[model samples]
Target: MSTVPPLNGSWLLRGRDGSLSAYAPRDEAVWCRAERHPGLPWAPPRRIGGDQRLHAQLALGQGADGYAHLVAWRPTVPGESGLVHSTHFRPHLAALDWVPIGHPDRKGDRTGLPAVAVDAEGRAHVFARNKGGGVGMLAQKERGGWGPWRDIGGPGAHEELAAVTGGSGRVELYATTSDGILRWRQEEPGATLVPDEALEASVRPGTLTALPTSKEHTTLFFADLEGMLHAWRPGTDPVPLLLAAGPGRVSALRCTIDDHDCTLLAQRSASGRAVFAACPTEQESAGLWWSESGPQLPVGTRVALAEDAEGRVVAATLSPDGELRVARQKDEPGLALGAWQSV
Candidate 1:
């Protein structure tokens, strides 16, 4: 059984050189900490605060240039929230000041967390649930300017949206709605986003995850209303993979183990402990088994997975109390984890 550790969602960023920097939202501000090198201890945390009050978790997206792009919802008065963005130019460095990227509907109420994905040309596409229950998108232009918000309609859109840039540089997006799951795909790099009618997959809100398993193909994973994990690619029916105990956002990473392509998944179980599973990439028909990894986490714990500079899989967990813990892939046989390091 593989023992993959857990993290506090996708907030963990791995630089090109394998340095790790972790970010999280605490109250009205966001904080960051980083390790200068692969085996170095984490430096002290730094606060990246803004004037507005943050109402949602920070969403991170990295571009080809290795800059960390962040988006967060800041709600001032009732029914008035705006999205703010920041960029961490490099690991262990100060990020640019937070800039406002106003919400889709200026006065929209009940707006959820925003999703961001950086395209091949370094454009940051931002998606949020608008007041009309549809998705509103604002993307960066090729010339480094922000575009006007476009309502890429998805009625009854709920929770956080999922956007990913495939290895082919195409941007794909997924959103869960009252009726079913919705998607938007870019025809090519720098192309306009086109939405597909909602897929019939009955995914629980906030449980959707998109993992690019190949150069040009991506797979979608999520827990159904009954807590069953399913994997689906475009034009294919949802393939049942695991019977998770509850439904929540699942963190996934596509990497190779012993030269075999694998997709690893992590989620907080109903018991508040983190569990993991791995399978052949894009081969859900093969088979899978889940293993409990880290100890019980605090409420609102998020998990994330990434490969380090030495090609070792790393998992991180962030607790509600602002504690960040990490474990890396051990040097043994199948996927195993080293001791958890709190920093």
Candidate 2:
């Protein structure tokens, strides 16, 4: 039988360059870097941090800070710990230097999933789950510096997918909770976060994403732990849709509205292979849910999918054969994007 590695972690990025990098922790006390690019296939995974075994959410893109950040969590005590993300890249020292965000309840405990989101204003909002007191902080990037975390709402991290998006109308913050989906407009005065139970009723998931597909509209998509992909209109509930079958795991996703219909792209692994499942159907159970696979990408690849300014489906997958694959057409001319050399 082919040995299958445990699927417990995930990675995300923003760009489609030949060389794209993301972070994951293989062993305790260390985090490793996985990269992909063109020309040379990627090398094997390598350790990138000295004292981080757990990674909340790793992103390989310039944040609102306009700087690349790689943040991870490390074990502190028993149930308590903290996270650190890079605000500045240290070229001379080798690995990027980092600054700690905060510690857990019990001195050094493992606080699950410390996610950081940087808005267009360069404000880095770092959140974590189970920080005790059912409370999470919303820290502002004051003077482009970290620290001074202020309290927001909710108990602990609530694990909401928080983000900021703008159109011709205004910029708004979007998130999902047990109460359903909620919104808070930044541009509007006295903007209060309110629940959209109708929208929430549509969202039968734990993950969501909001991306601008046109010059004036934004859409959100999600896939709970289950491999189902759903889309939410700007002010509507999630229209659940089936995307794939088999014991497939969705690694990455993106949603962008095109004209009247919305498009969702997700990276999924099934039957020991990696494939991109892009749906054009506005209905939940519509479209072919197309996927591509070959003999080479057996270890499966991590898919980082996104939509361009034009709203076309663009996918980036790091193949088992070390190729950094990108494709616009689900049925494309090549099998992989480009070969990446390992370091």
Candidate 3:
């Protein structure tokens, strides 16, 4: 059995079982079921009212109240789907309570997968692309109610959003348009969201990730279609690191290790092997080094990376054969990784 470990003091890993039902790992091998449909025998056999099949994509964030919030989308039929939200109150608990939020959508709208981030006030902000290719947002109010979905105004078709919270009352959203334009929006507590013009980065038209290093600074990372890895800050030009080109999707996370700012990136090679790299400084002079090889992953496998409170970075991936595997970095400032282990 493979397992997914929660990072950054988080206690839950939201994913789907072999049956496509929502579940959270109770341990390395045991999964606590999240589906509520009693009709589905493979899903813990509960009576919760909602769609049973959860889309493979998930967004997780820790709220100000010390609880972790998860959001996922489920397809209802050929042309409609709905968003599901769940909360984990206690770390030791095995199950989570899930509820539906926002309105259902028709299939043609091509609304991309949703992304979430928790504000300083403990409210959860959700962003997604509308059918018309504009970005839309929904936020949790201070009193525990969900605000109406409103347009944040960015022109992009099939774009994915990534969010990071900085300082006390600031949240930043990043996305790439179909035409390869990078745009961002800044929201301060109760202020309006006015996005800046498209940025001048040679990025491909795909998902991008963002990490906030300070109140006014954030680092963005993305892989071009040719498999070249790139990183960019707000005012500086993008820095490309020397790494092997592969078709694997790129994922990144920023954490402080041994008092040094470390950024970790993971992707799969063309041979279905996992590769990892670490950069300890703002400049690319340190260069990129590959970690020890792991077991072969399925082609086009998706990977997720997170850092724990101890500054250890953990990576999780679902193999093409439906097995979930995990691995961790050995120490700080070194690109070495432990052998991949199944749950």
Candidate 4:
């Protein structure tokens, strides 16, 4: 049988245009600016709203009321470290038209990476990593200013946080922790953040996808450190074994557990081989869902280029052909690859 052809696309994008944007603290206001990209000559960056430095981990969230509410937390500098001095970034609204937000708070000297969630009424919840290396207080945004910052629960330690709209006035916060992923209630009675539960995955920075389990239900997916991924819920413990180990360090982890689509994409450092493996939980023997971008070519190290909805894979490498190469499963019962592309 002939090998099936997989999808084709460009190499992973890199350059100045890809620089990361961060929210920094000005004297009494927060400055939303671009900082970390391969090469964009930004003019010392710019400022926007809020008073404290927001964490870079807060990805751009949903926009509403003609404004994009940025969620961020600032860690305390070593000297002024304390529960009182640690957190500095306060949540605020940035107008869709590009108007700056709050005045910088000179008195507040501390901040950390804060997980942010905004509700239907534009209420924002800010959670931070603190001086003692624990999760910090929860703060909210009211009208044009920030309400007082309240301690959610140092008990529930979270490195990354995800917030989504749920029940009556309640917003939900999901977090990744050493013990597992956990959650806390917000916007209602018992809205205090506590240890919701353990996550199935054993790490942070995992890609999260929201799934609707029932008419009024939803779940999340996250990958662990060992290349394994898990399905999680706010109060329930993570369900493990969602995705088995892939080709390399989980450069790209995807879970369609809601659809049983447990495909993991990775790259091998030693062989410069790209792998696309299927991770079936019920079947222990499904083994690796892999493809070699250039096992035959002189590849120094493999870097995952991209993967799509159809389980197709692409990788980039420093080979004679080009930096970006192609790897796809052919119809011959195994995966195959062609030459590399310049882009």
Cα-based TM-score, every candidate: 0.93, 0.64, 0.76, 0.46
Best by lDDT: 1
**Order by lDDT, highest first:** 1, 3, 2, 4
Give the backbone clash total of model 1: 9
Query: Which 10-residue window of candidate 4 scores lowest in summed lDDT?
Result: 2-11
Prediction 3 TM-score vs. true? 0.76
For residues 1-343, what per-residue lDDT tens digits would candidate 1 score against the true structure?
Answer: 2222221127887865568888887757788888977668988988774455676467888887877888887775786667888888777777888888887886555477778898888888888888788888898878887888888887877867899988888788898877778999888777768886458867788788898888867898888888888998888788999897445678899877878999999877778777788999988888987788888887677777888878898999887777889999999988899888888
- 3 against 4, candidate with superior lDDT: 3
Encode model 2's per-residue lDDT on 231-291: one tens digit a residue.
6665555666565433433443335333334454554456544455544434445653556
Which candidate tops TM-score?
1
Better of 1 and 2 by lDDT: 1
TM-score comparison, 1 vs 2, better candidate: 1
Global CA lDDT computed for model 2: 0.45
Put down candidate 4 lDDT per residue, 171-262, tens digits, no spaces.
Answer: 55665556665665553532555554444556645344333243244456566776565555555566554453332223443334334644
lDDT of each: 0.80, 0.45, 0.58, 0.41
Candidate 3 has which clashing residue pairs, if any? Answer: 36-48, 79-107
- C-alpha positional error of residue 238 in candidate 1 after TM-score superposition, expressed in Å: 0.8
Candidate 1: residue 246 Cα off by (Å): 4.0
Clash totals in order: 9, 23, 2, 35
